[model samples]
Target: MPSHAPDRFDEVPGDLSRVGAHRAPRPRHHRVRAFAWAAL
Candidate 1:
């Protein structure tokens, strides 16, 4: 019989709320110009 121990288990949460939570949105002009310049 195979037995597993609960005490040896660990729980991890996917928490993105704490990361980059205060970053400002990218400017629309920069995004559009970047692609246009790259395509040339």
Candidate 2:
């Protein structure tokens, strides 16, 4: 059971770092594009 604990703990931070690094730029671009289209 102790071996399982470290594996489970590693998953949460791993997912967060990936999302922060890779996903952070995309939604921001989409948001700006939507605003631009709405203004037009």
Task: Quote each prediction's TM-score.
Answer: 0.30, 0.31
**Whole-model lDDT per candidate:** 0.58, 0.58
> Which pairs clash in the backbone of model 1?
none
- Per-residue lDDT of 1-40 in model 1, one digit per residue for the tens? 9987766224334552433444344567987899899999
Candidate 2 lDDT at 24 equals 40
Shift of residue 8 alpha carbon in model 2, Å: 28
Best by TM-score: 2
- Each model's number of backbone clashes? 0, 0
lDDT digits (tens) for residues 1-40 of candidate 2: 3554466435444344355336443555788899899999
- What does candidate 1 score on TM? 0.30
Shift in Å, residue 3, candidate 1: 62
